[model samples]
Target: MMKEGGCRPRAASPLKWLTQRPTRVTRAWCSGPASPAPADLWSTLKKALFIIGSSTIVFVALRNSLTYHLQHFWGASGDFWQHQWDKILHTYGDNPFTFMVYGTTIVSYVVYWTVGLLYTFVDMTGYPAILKRYKIQPGTNEPVETWKLIKCILWVNFNQIFVGVPFSMACFYLLRLRGWDESRQLPTFHWVIIELIICILMEEIGFYYSHRLFHHRMLYKHFHKMHHEWQSPISITAIYAHPLEHALSNMMPVFLGPLLMGSHVATIWLWVSLALLSTLNAHSGYHLPFFPSPEAHDFHHLKFNQCYGVLGVLDLLHGTDDKFRASKCFSRHLMMLSLVPPREAYPDVLPKGKVIRGKQCYDQPSEDSQ
Candidate 1:
């Protein structure tokens, strides 16, 4: 080597040679390619299945024990309801559909106003620091005007009376045509559970598809745009929508499951109450302790295109929740375990670097910016 060029090539050092390898190869080895979407989806699905299965087993076990202990109480309650139903039937000329319409309307009013007004009060007043800390999206309720609130209240009531009454009648008749037995005695706990599960599944499927359909460009302006008026909805805003959307997307999904199952009138009443409570909670704008987190639906309200389904199963399957899953809110998305503010309650989950205000999460700026 020295004879040819009048210089000797330095002996290659193994460590130096290794260090000089292609940077790309080294980087690639250290940080592998991102996991494929399908693998991530499968993992999500597995987690969901495990949670659902475990919950179902626990629910069944608890229901069995509770039903056995409360059999006499249930019997007494059923009898009391039957006596009340007799009076209602007599007053309404034995029209079960009329009873159903009246019952449903009354239940809706009670649940809506009781829960909705409490939330509205908080929205306007922002009092009782106890409840304020759990406020999922801050600053949303602060700027809402009183007249706008009143307008929403009036329109919601009007919808319940006009659109809701007719729709209830139609649903009752449809169930009748399908041979639903309105005169059946109070349903057994087992039958109620089975019917409820079916109803929930049907409602989830119907709501997801119909809700997504309403978001279509051709349909949204005329049918569903009103519902989206409240980007950060309060409890009362759950049913606030165009009459058409309320009928097809909101009411129909809740009714479809019961209709298909031919559930008893008593069971239907129970279902209606539970469904109303669930929706109110979702739209309440507060993520209180011991309640299901409203984050998913809240995110839907904020983003508009994601989390279209109630339980998120459909959204997950369809990848509509991809953005939601990536969000900071998702990291703090567990049910509130303590009464304290989420920041204090779950310090580990929501580290101090960022804060959630309204629909946005960002790093804390200086006090002047605040």
Candidate 2:
């Protein structure tokens, strides 16, 4: 609120200063509320630190154990290359059951826990305080119910392990049956990059249309409504949705890209992991510096009709975010323009004032001019 090199005199009473923003009930109706204080934030951070420490220890142990098992299975014998070819590529890759188990286990842990734990850490570490400190729009000041948050975590884990993994293996097996497996050429870094770009394009286009469909009057009330319940969502809420919506709107887009591209299995896994991280970041709730801000998607959850796409290109073309762009949520950062010094901002102009005023200097006849 402060202008460049300018200050307002304090209000006479402490109550006047406290009542300046809005009453609690009134603020609940509008998007973008105040943040918590530093002391409250510090308390939350201690809990987050403990969770993070424990998770790290568990993850390290899991990684070491998996590595030892994988090495024993594939590399312990004299011929490492032969063992990898026979057991991993030939046996695991070709068989649907083996592939599904391997895919689900690895993907469930890497993508699910990576995004889930990070979300938990940020949410616990006072993301609301961060949002408030930055004056970001539609900030989530209140806490979510612990039981509901835990339920979201469990559902997402289940979706990844049971639905997502099995579906992926089925797609692969179908492709193999159709001789698509023949095109699974050895992937170089360049091809992998190209595949990733193609995957993003495919996903953006697919998700844009599919997501818009979910916003339809009839569909929204049934399937997509569950996800919209959380306007200011935490990270796990990215994947938390009705099962039908999760499969059709969420998983299908990701699966389609790799299938269309005939990507190697490793490439598909890599893409999915990165895509999960992208979605998680988009729903992270915090406006942390150097991180992707979830303002657009968050606006969608609050406004309920705009910003349906991931990349937002389709939204821009369709003018979906027009109302959102005009709202306080989108314009909060623009308020910082008031902080730019007029002198430096207008370097070509010369001042000819007898006295300086707030944010402006008026031209006046000086002694030299007379």
Candidate 3:
């Protein structure tokens, strides 16, 4: 079976502490059979129009709703100041049940559905035939496993059960017994300060590793592939994952936090907030002016099978980042990706594997491609 293998040299560190160079992957494997297109990118104009338009509507609506609700609850917009207890040194009395339970359920739902409808709307409209564009995802003509999909969705959404709930209740109620009941110290060190930091650190590292492993060929088909079902039209539907992946991907922030004794209410707020917004933006498929676009992960969805770390740092560090120097997933926007010729595009590693069957013949037709 024909195969491809190569490794490019690592560039200088974008981050400060550089003790080791990243080990890059430069091989494409083809399944025993054929697959569809080489790539899965949408038109610049259409992709821009669709994902961006939907985001604006959702952003505005969600912001407005959140504001309206917060005002209804606290007589003003919900921000750090909302937690102020009339005195500067007073505690932040936030209801964990509200934010952790009601708040998340509400936000992920609204934000998710907005994204979902947007994608569906785009698909229904005469948009650039995105699904078929790059043969972007070789979703099986095999009937969608409806039962399995539903099971996965329910299990995936219960992430907080494992991550947020037990840990928050047990550690805060049992180990620390520190609830934000009025006299909660105003953003100062809590009873479980060390655990909070440790939990977040471990979880972040765990998230990074699990994410990378999901891209491994064996795991991708069984678990991670469902998330990539729609290429250019990334929306809220993108959040759900395999029930099996629930332990790995979903409840991480919660479970790891507790194990590390992260039992504070405020710290939990910050982490949860970031998790919500970040996950929404992950499917945005384009970057914001002040933030990395949805394209960061969108790039992952396209010519997938490589580049699996978050915030572009770990992936960049380990040389797993295939966006620029290694893989051609960004072939759709070579102009944006190309800084110079790839002298080591396919450095010889003498890789051993079957022909990366489907990928080579899968990309869109263009002057630069084979």
Instruction: Write down the TM-score of every candidate.
Output: 0.80, 0.61, 0.48
Kindly indicate the candidate among 1 and 3 with the higher TM-score. Answer: 1
What would the per-residue lDDT of candidate 2 be over residues 1-370, giving only the tens digit for each residue? Answer: 6423343223344543211222223322333433444544455456556765796698677976765675565446546644444566664566544543476448746776776676576555555343434323323524557787888888787777677766666776765665443332345544666688788878888888888878776788998888877766777888788887887889888877777877666676678888888787677665455555566786677667777787665665455665666554453312133333223333222355533221222233346855
Query: Per-residue lDDT for 1-370 in model 1, tens only?
Result: 4424243333455543221212222322334444554686688788779878999899878986777766656567657756766776777676677667877888777877888888788788877757766777776777468887887888898889999899888988898898886773666766787898998998999999899888877899988888888888888888988888889988999998889998887788888888888898999888888898888898889888878899888776666776677665676677866666664554323345865556674323336744
The local distance difference test score of model 3 is: 0.46
Error of 1 at 224 (Å): 2.2
Q: Which ten residues in a row have the lowest lDDT in candidate 3?
A: 341-350
| TM-score between candidate 2 and the true structure | 0.61
The prediction achieving the highest TM-score against the true structure is: 1
Candidate 2 Cα outliers beyond 4 Å, as residue runs: 1-97, 125-142, 181-186, 331-370
The model with the greatest lDDT is 1
Q: lDDT scores for all predictions?
A: 0.76, 0.62, 0.46
Candidate 1: what lDDT? 0.76
Error of 2 at 76 (Å): 25
Worst 10 residues of 2 by lDDT: 356-365
